[model samples]
Target: MSKLVNKSQCVVICCFPANYTVGLTTVVEALALGIPLICTKNVQMPMDIDHEHCGITVEPGDMGGWEKAVNYIAENPDVASDMGRRGRELAEKVYNLDNCAKDVSAVLKTLIKK
Candidate 1:
């Protein structure tokens, strides 16, 4: 697991179980460690993944689907690395206290403006 996390140019997450939010934490950890994500649409992962911008999603259980996703990410090292950097940026933007508060405040102010 650690090697995959360490040496992988990209990280592919295959999650298909119902209510499987378990992978989210690990995905976030990978992002924190600068790993790009190639995930499946299964278990709400497509929504979690940032589409082709930060991650690629493929239909679950398609033969070679996982490989395709990983290869796609691997083929474009620049895009993959940018996505990894963006993932960390997103985490900082959404998870940090100051950034979270600012985002919340902006949303609340927008609601009040209506």
Candidate 2:
């Protein structure tokens, strides 16, 4: 999956609300691979893809919106590249394992002190 995503221009993760578990495995994978994303707004996401400037969201079941999104990425190379870069930066900030361990230890230490 990582290899495939690394080679992808962008990733589209369109799904219905409650169609499956709203895990961010695919999303984080795309971010880690530095690929821009087009996902459904139905997703129960932890972060704002739009606010993060990592991707755009489409209304669920909107075929025209999907078409527009793909065209936007294909036609706007600079913007797409920026989005991918931002995605990678966000993944590094939020998902780096070493940073995660440090954050967890801080919380644990605080609890221990309490």
Which candidate number maximizes TM-score? 2
lDDT of 1 at 41: 68
Clash count, predicted structure 1: 0
How would you encode candidate 2's per-residue C-alpha lDDT over 35-84 as one tens digit per residue?
A: 89998875458778899999988888999999999999999989999999
Global lDDT scores for all candidate models: 0.71, 0.86
TM-score, candidate 2, is: 0.79
State which candidate has the highest lDDT: 2
Mind giving the per-residue lDDT tens digits that candidate 1 earns over 1-114?
687677778877776655556467667676667778777665644235755366776676865887777777878889888988887776665545586578789999999999
Candidate 1, after superposition: displacement of residue 21 in Å? 1.6
How far residue 8's Cα lies from its native spot in candidate 2, in Å, is: 1.0
Residue 40 lDDT in candidate 1: 63
